[model samples]
Target: MRIYGPNGTTLGAPTGNTRRAGASGFALPDAIATPETRAAATPKAAGNIDALLAMQGIEDPLERRKRSVQRGRGALDVLDDLKIGLLSGNFDASTVNRLRDAAASLKSTSGDPGLDAVLSEIELRVEVELAKAGQF
Candidate 1:
């Protein structure tokens, strides 16, 4: 059992003094650093610009075929439109302009001989139509 002092006498007094725990005799080794130290340790970034440019330069055969198909289809569609316009007696010069643009796109080779041959045939039809319209 314990007894307490008067409340007024112990009101502002501290409970006890604190002390650091003593070392246990075990110590950790210091870290060893490399002799070569960098003044500014900046991270190096990969050169993606060159890689992206190289990728852009590479042409895909499938993609080329697809583009050729689209161009051929587009030219045929324009020819159909021109025929409809002429038969309806409402022919427009803009149709001829679109035909001209299609003709330009059809000149590129698709790398596949079969596709190129088909595209050439379509190109010939476009030229004939252009000549008839006096826009060749």
Candidate 2:
């Protein structure tokens, strides 16, 4: 417990305070920090290629992840192409809406940041390409 004056001046504090028992109930705070530090220092997700290969149930985790990433990138690229076609009056409203929904679904389901970055770079390239082609 701490004692304070009217202006929040520190008067005194009790050294032997057995306050909250719900705080892991450890005698010292450092006792609780060791396990937490170890947990945080290690990766939580199962990403080891060897571990994935040892699984009999999972045929190929790495291959599936790669394919999913590539598929997502392709979907985003197709959407970008459709958007450009719509802006150029080559595609109709329904085509534009379908491509937009496909892009949204890919964004929702994709777990790879690398693929997302690739998609962003591809969009930039498409814009530059369009300018060079005198479309914009």
Candidate 3:
């Protein structure tokens, strides 16, 4: 294919599989091991477990309630997406799995009785859908 320069001049005609000079030709030094790179490459054991325990240990009631509300809303959004996918006949096992996972993560209460009722109803609907799809 013809390659043009900035001024619309034809630079060169290169065919497919042509490799430009200086591309992928550089190598890192053998002695370039750094603590930061080593740490990044290594997996930290108990990191996620510690974080989950810390979250559960949170002392603020309002913070916990907020997190619950956010989770409930997220599950609701997943249900909405599932509804759309079902209507369009474009859903798959992954979509159903997402809905199930979201529903499972949601709390039954969010410090608001009305919202909790709505979330419970949504969760029931999700369960029904999963049952109908043979996923339950």
Candidate 4:
């Protein structure tokens, strides 16, 4: 295969001529690690751990509600799939396994009473289905 250069010109053989530069005004800042800077930049392990613990303690109620809703929806979808599979006599063990997993995820409280109630209902349905499948 032949190579082509810009403007669709066929590439020719390379030449030996070369160019060199003498000087440039650019100068790098001193980046050497000194003891003073090292001490200043070093992170406090205790403070970092405390901050991480604090962050973990903070939970947004809306986010929790959203997560619970998603879990409920996933359980409903699996239930629908299970129903379809049963009706069609094409049931698979993996769908039962997924229903079990969805059941586990539904146990977390969403910090909202109505959402928690709905999720509880979904969880109950999942449990019923799992029981019928002999996997509970």
- Which candidate comes out best when scored by TM-score? 1
Clashing pairs in 3: none
TM-score of 4: 0.63
Q: How well is each residue in 13-108 modelled by candidate 1, as lDDT tens digits?
A: 333332324465433332352233326545566777889889999989999889899999999999999999998998999999999999999999
Clashes of 3: 0
What TM-score does prediction 3 earn?
0.50
Q: Compared with the true structure, what per-residue lDDT tens digits does model 4 show for residues 1-136?
A: 7646332334333222323233755343334533221123444356678889889999898888888889899999999999999999999999999998999999899989988899999999999889889943
Evaluated against the true structure, the overall lDDT of model 1 is: 0.81
Candidate 4 clash pair list: none
RMSD of 4: 14.3
Segments in model 1 whose C-alpha atoms lie over 4 Å from true places:
1-45
**Candidate 2 to truth, TM:** 0.31
Q: Against the true structure, what is every candidate's RMSD?
A: 18.1, 16.7, 18.1, 14.3
How far off is residue 125 in model 1, in Å?
A: 1.3
lDDT of each: 0.81, 0.53, 0.68, 0.79
lDDT tens digits, residues 1-136, model 2?
A: 7635433335333234434567566443343343221123343566786877677556465665676677556666665676687689785555445545444444432345776577556555544444444443
